[model samples]
Target: MSFRRVIIGLLCLAGLAVVLDFGAAAYSEYRVSRLLRDGSDLGADPEVTFHGFPFVAQALDGQFRDIDIRARAVRPDIPGEILVEAGLIGVHAPLGDLVDGNVRKVPVDEVHALMRIEPVELGRLFKIPDLQVFGPPADKSDGSGGSGGTGVTTSGPIILTGTVSLTSDTNPVPGTSDSGKPVSVLADLRLDADGQIQIVATDIYYGDEATPAAMVPEVNRELVLAKFTRTIDTRDLPFGVRPMKVEASGGQIVVEGVGKNVTIDLDRLQQP
Candidate 1:
């Protein structure tokens, strides 16, 4: 064969290889979406992206360097829905399973995820209408330095405001004559040692009028405690990541965490 012909043939082969590699990557994405949706009860199809070129080579090695999946409106039998984004590292998948068209399990070395829960959904979970929660700069108390220089120091505190129902028999609100009267209050958001969310009413208000906690009655305080305290379960998050931190920003709650050495099955994820 002529040398020029040989060169042309090699170029064609390289082009074909590139096309095949792209197809393989596309197939991998589809398979991952199906696996997560069918096995994990994900609310919607997750967007999966495979990192690195030549996915076929990664498949042969039975490991992927990086994979990302983003899911929206994920409702995992939890009280509220959240948007979840996960980055998986060192994912292992068997070539044999891929050939058989049955991807049973995938194990990952590490998984990092971020979950965003909107304020509206949180309000619904709390049974409060039109709830607004945010972290505002705390009041800066006047201070004096050792040299007698006056200054101010700032603190951070999370505040939550909502109309709380007073008619509930279990925990009735005090100072309300009518059953359906809604009371507005500014509550403090705190996390307990066990990672549970606790809402404590620091001040109560009635149409811009401040109500003293003493005059609110003891039963009303108990009502506030009972109505606002909630425990968030973090054991079984998406991709098995445990929630480590929670923050309020832009009227939403952002929870972020990481998982180590987790195994997932496509079939099990589909179960309720």
Candidate 2:
């Protein structure tokens, strides 16, 4: 056989090997996605992406460096839909066990995740059906939103009513006899000791986003702030994502979490 022919055969074999590796990785990703969706009770299959090529090597070695996942509607049993973007780091799962469909426990060195909290969650927690979170006031001098001008932190917007009215009605404005007093939620999102989102509204400006008005009545000041100032329970989440930082982004609240040296027990993904 010619030397060139031998070289060509070797090249073909290498190409086939690469194709097979990708196929295997794709299959594994599909299987893991299904498990995550059903086990976590997510609305649909979570997007799973394995890091690095030659995934077969990682599987044979039984250690995965990183795996990214984006899941919509996680923890359906919990109030409000939860969206999740997570990364699994240093996972340990043998290929044989996984192939046999007997794989159960998936231990990871760390799991970093971002949980996007939609308006519905805040509405239920804040007792406002139409709660709106917005970016800092366009005019910094207006003080409609909070970012301290540096723009690192953010706050939610409040169209106040209910006890906020104080005059009579206890429902959100527009429903109250008086028109809805537009209040921007200048709240600082913090995680309480219990891992709950503790929103402390530092102040509220009564006006639309474009226009900034005087602060509400001092007596009504604390009253209006009180409606948004409270620790909300969100401990019940899929994949055991623990809250780290809660911030307002693009008119929404997103809480980032990280779990270190975590073990995923597929049987009790929810544990509820």
Candidate 3:
């Protein structure tokens, strides 16, 4: 009987400790979130989470295995609202400083940030008020409309459909009703050696990507598809990380990068 009672007591204590640890972790997240939001251009409070079990042990050691922070509408004066997601590995934050309510400096071993732009936002930036991105159709698809054919893969060249204005009247694009007409462009998104995201169009269709789409003449293609091609600078990437790769996924443009042995101060945290 005494043995069972002792075992029950120890189990209760363990459960209580787990509860307290979670509570402490939540409080820690709140503190870090507040600090991240302060002295920065973060339009909203960052969603912070720590990975690995035994949060209390990691907290006491002042080292976290991995941590993630997410925020929306980061920075101001950009073309549109952007979502930023940052993942830090081997994060070092002294427990004393954290408890003292003033974490002077957080040195992270590795950092990766993802900047996502929705299709609508991309359209706004490119001056195409109605832009859409979709994966290329499978072998069975005819590539008439954006996602018009089924069996779309998650990766690879995306079809961009929008109204583009043709400046060069050198040669007329087929089925053009106005200077600005609905067009579908099959473009490949690739990272250039010069640190730029280049959208190179392979084929362009007139009168929307519908049944029996009309292909633009190659001679006048440059004039009609000029706006469809673009070179984007990687300087505006979050956390000052070099733009590593870009892809169109789930109807959004995602630019991801990684940094090593980085320090996160208040100022550094604010601008991203």
Candidate 4:
């Protein structure tokens, strides 16, 4: 081929690459913007801005307001999952009793999370990841909302809630061991007024022989105890100390409030 022809061909290829790059950038921007708009439509007043090719969102509460979530990386056994980092994100309370004044505020900290949603047996999906909360936080003093008034007011203590379908592995860690030894969960969880969350659940799975039939006394008790300990753990700093017991009935488990200053790890309890 002539040298001039070869040079022209290379220039054409370079131009095509540029066009493709621009197209991808534009699409990413659109995706980010769409996500923000959705949050706004859901009553979120968040700030959205593009940082290079990445979209950044800051919500009034540390929730998932103007954030970006990448959908392609969600797959089973595929380690690379989408990372969703949000701020000032709060939970929507359809029930009023949970909040003191019916007012829910988002936490101030940034919630950084690595998550994956997998549809496995029965087309069920599970969310896995470690979420961390950082920054100065508004007080979760009571469930009375922000204003500390009685009834279902807008301002009150904040509680974060999410659904875990039975299909996926929800418990990252087994709450206890067979020999009645205390197993510490390497997880942290907290809820703020803005409706943001930061928590971790690790090492959760059942053994080949592990089944509901075999999960008598030991397994059952551990599961109950785990919930009880978690409720008191978060308020430890403010309340001095709290101890509790957990009971399960029907499909729901209940944690009974213990007296005071005594904290017991349910994994350490023996079946009576």
Best candidate according to lDDT: 3
| Candidate 1 per-residue C-alpha lDDT over 46-158 given as tens digits, one digit per residue, 9 for 90 to 100 | 78898987888998898889988777645544455677778889988875575355766678898877776677677787787656554543334544221111121111244
Looking at model 3, residue 265 earns an lDDT score of: 60
Candidate 1: clashing pairs of residues? 38-270, 39-269, 39-270, 40-269, 40-270
C-alpha lDDT (0 to 100) for residue 161 of candidate 1: 51
TM-score of 1: 0.66
Tens digits of per-residue lDDT for model 2 on 105-139?
Answer: 78889988777777676666666666666555455
lDDT (0 to 1) per candidate? 0.61, 0.65, 0.70, 0.27
Cα TM-score per model: 0.66, 0.73, 0.79, 0.19
Ranking by TM-score: 3, 2, 1, 4
Deviating ranges (above 4 Å) for candidate 2: 1-15, 74-78, 99-101, 135-181, 206-219, 236-238, 268-271
Best candidate according to TM-score: 3
Model 3 alpha-carbon miss at residue 211, Å: 9.3
State the lDDT of candidate 4 residue by residue for 1-272, as single tens digits: 69999999999997886676556445544543344434323222223232232111211221223222222222232233322222212222221211122322322122222222121211121131211111111235765333211111121111111222122244422223232222222223333333222233332222221111112234344443233223212112101212132221111111222222232221111111
Error of 4 at 126 (Å): 50
Itemize residue pairs with steric clashes in candidate 3: 144-209
Model 2's lDDT to the true fold?
0.65
Q: What is the lDDT, from 0 to 100, of the residue 126 in candidate 4?
A: 18
Question: What is the Cα-based lDDT of residue 111 in candidate 2?
Answer: 84
